[model samples]
Target: MLTPWRLFLCQMALNIFYHIAKEIGEMESKWRLLHKANIKLCSQLIFTFITWQMSGYLTTKNSSLCLGGQDIFATVRENSPTGEIIAHLSINGDPGASSIRLCLTGENADWFYLEGRTIRLNSSFSRTLDREVLGSVLIAALTCYEDDIIRSRYRIMVEILNENDNMPYYLEDTIQPRYISELLTVNSMVFTVKARDGDGDTITYMTDKSTADASYFRIDLPNSGMVILDKPLDYETKTQLQVVIFAVETTTKEKYSTTATVTVNVLDGDDQYPQFQPCAPVYEDGDHNICTNPVYSVNITETDEDAVLYFSPGPIHAEDGDKDILTPLVYSILSGDGNGRFTIDSKTGEISLRQRVENRLLTPSFRLRIMAAQVNDPKKYSVATALVHVVSENRFPPFFNKTVYKGFLIESSSPATLVTTYGNQVLVVQAIDRDFRDGINPKIHYTMQPLTGSNKLYHISQDGIVIAKTDRLRAFDRHILEVIATDEESGETAHASVDIEVLQRGQPVPRSPFGEERLFGDMNAGMAGGIAALVLLVAVTVLFLFLWLAKRRRERRDPADRGAVALGKHPNVEASSPIAPRHVL
Candidate 1:
């Protein structure tokens, strides 16, 4: 029905309308700029009004080209060539010879390129994704353009596939030395092994065959980085150990591993008690061990309070069973010598007196118990005993037991009445020398001093015996005698007084009074004095009462007589009104 020229015009008008509609769509969406040719064609078609109405009818039948903005996923081997094609993109609507162009946009555009409908790589990728540089996901937009006009956009994603290229290595280039106690229990975690894989693969840890005794150590696998001890360690045998560890990738096709050398130093622990050397012989007391010998004897010839008396109980030697080098043995006193008179050196275990032994009479000897223990473990110890003997020189005088003595005699008795005897005999003058243990003064002699009253009244013999000089007739006479005991060796003298009571013959001999009866007599005397005071008080009271009764009777009679006289003088005056003073009665 239409002519050739008209049909040609109609097709050109429809094409212009469709292009103008696309340009308007692109302007509304505000996508990336299209090519320079598409922009010039859209500007020229915009001036034709009839073409604008025809474009609506023609474009209504032809759907607009769209990319749907759907995401695409592709994976390629690592280190692939740049510009490698991954996948071809398809448009959803018809675009007829409009010069469709494709381009990448956004931050990932530098790494990717779009050629026609194909997505290609712009740069090579590493299998190990460096999130710090390229990030985890590559985000890019592929823009579709027709005749220099943008129609739609789509998102493209490309992931780099991993390759086994790098071996595992320790996380730290150089491992720090580790220290473990010798007393550490078996199967205890000593340290952790940290490693990393360049390919981001799971790493498994294992002890290398070159390690020192693999039976003593074990490694936990991928999940745990712990290295455990399989056997106990001793510092005495081996102080240090070297361990070789290997970290391998779990999923790598070719076994790729890295080695790390760790120096493990074994530390000392408080595992052994101190031991003493054979300085003295040890004696046992019912399962208890005691050290003897090294008998130290000192004669206390002089007295010095502040001087130090040094005596070596010999050097103390001890050794630890664990052979720990860091800790040493220390010595101390455990018991005996509670006064702290003896002290031992902590390092050498040598014993000495802190103060001088001034008097052997007081403390004759000292018994001390010394203990040696490890400084690290004080509770683990060993004990030994030391006996110290003291000898004393004669430096004191003889002392008498009693300062005075009493004796009785008859005035008219015969001569040699056997008054008293001394020197280890009956009624003797006892003297003791403190420097001797026997307490008896063997070199002591007794003599009597002259009496003042009668010169020859009494005499003392060499053996300490007092005898009457003559028969006397004096009643109630007392004689005093001084008996002196002298030490022949040291010339030290001790004296005692003897009081001799002379009683008349046939006079009742007085007996020594009992102590309890004397106390009872004193009580009776106090009670009698109290009774006499009470009797005197009662007698005084009775006399006062008798005088008072007599005075009252006289007062009564005087009043009756006055009444008779007053009645005769004036009847108004009453005579019975006058009374005696109360104090008089």
Candidate 2:
């Protein structure tokens, strides 16, 4: 015999089967019906079936069987084994019901099974789901049955909460190489890092503190995996940097992380000026100022016929302080090169003469001012000077200013007499070297050759000055003196004959047209006396003028009382002037 509760559940089960068959038939004919009508009917049937199933399980009038009304949640580990109980389901009014059975049905019913009141995994369950089948939230219908009949139907939601089983790893195993200029501003974007977690957990990016200093960089978390430069970089100090980046799960208690190496190559920039190597210590001038730049000396002789005259004076070198190593430098002649005789390599600091020096006798020495600058920035530079000394081979002899020089002296003139003043330079003979572009030659010296005379009458000074040795000669007498100009280095010589004419005391000298002899003693005495008399006259005139001006000022103050005279008068005299006149007389 079937009980009333049993019979009611049996009827509900038949109703459920009928509704499910009808839904299938409607689905096949769904295209034929109006879209709205079909949807409305399907919804009504679903709601009625759920209501009927709930009402069958409630035995008492006050008992309620909530279908999708009461919230149900279950947490399951990802990839759980089949038949693993996730959570137990309970009907509100059921306690110790021997005939009650739990059945799972819905879109994801295939993934779970029901055992009495417990919900267990029927198949291997993965947290990762396809939206077409089952979304992130697993919804199923948990139905209580009695004797193979539906009693109550409840909608349950199984949320597969993620666990830290899967570690976070970088999307790319290695980061792409990034190039950043040393001059890049701080807080600039360097590169981005991307990471993924199979468990769908929030991932945080960070730099490995042990690998490199994290102070110079910062990482954006969660969605954005961008890395930025927190501080400036210098290529000179460090050329390349490797930063280890870690991607970690934010919710994991353990330190589960994935690492990737980011190679940051610092590029060179034009930030530093060129610095020249310090030359030899240079002495300061008298005024404590650097009179000369760094000097490099090179000796070139006439016999030296090398094809390339390398300027090895001091190997010019310049370095860019901003670069990790010395960069390319350019060399140029800044000044002191009047002629285009030398050229230097722009990349290398090697300097060479463009043309060979045919004659070193003329130009014994010269100087050149050279500049070294970085190739990147030419304006940033340093300057140095080089002195080139030449050794002559005496290809040409010295030449005199004049072939014949005429001189005059007074007859019986005293030794070292004022024949010619060094300041005036009357009897000067200049010798020049044709080998040099500049006519003046410092090597050639002047001297008087041996003359046919008992005593050396006259001699030529090194500076080409003719001086008389003694005061012994006759009037109208003449002497011919030969001045030999010799080159100290080349041993070459040239001579010029100087003709000297003697004159009497009154006769005019040949070269001294202004009459060089003068009585300086008398002239000086006259000049002194004239100056003293003029000073005395000026003093007397000033004193007389001062006295006359004083007398005129006194007269202007007392004009009317100039000639009046006062006489003493007796006190008792009655007449006005009889006693006064006697006293006055």
Q: Each candidate: what lDDT? A: 0.65, 0.66
Which 10 consecutive residues of model 2 have the lowest summed lDDT?
A: 559-568
Candidate 1 lDDT tens digits, 129-153: 3443453467777777766677777
Q: Candidate 1: which stretches are off by over 4 Å?
A: 1-72, 89-100, 115-117, 124-136, 173-175, 220-222, 275-314, 319-347, 351-371, 374-378, 383-585
Error of 1 at 414 (Å): 99
Write model 2 residue lDDT over 1-585, tens digit each, in one string.
Answer: 334555455456545655676778855344334333444445555556756867875643254432222446876655556887867665653434655556678887777875655668766445433332343567788776665666567777777655556678776643887888999998788888888876677788878767654666887544587888887887766778888888888776875788888889999877766655543435655422222334666666756543344444346566676645566788888875547766667777666665667777777776887787876667777788777667755567788878877676665556675344222347777798888778667878888864545257676777777777546666666677788988765657888887766655654443344645432332455687798899999999999999999998877864333423122334343445456655756
- For candidate 2, the per-residue lDDT at 59 reads 49
Candidate 1 — worst ten consecutive residues by lDDT sum?
Answer: 513-522
lDDT of 2 at 120: 82
Give candidate 2's whole-model lDDT. Answer: 0.66
TM-score, candidate 2, is 0.42
The clash count of every prediction, one per candidate, is: 4, 1
TM-score of each: 0.42, 0.42
**Relative to the unseen true structure, what is the C-alpha lDDT of residue 339 in candidate 1, on a scale of 0 to 100?**
81
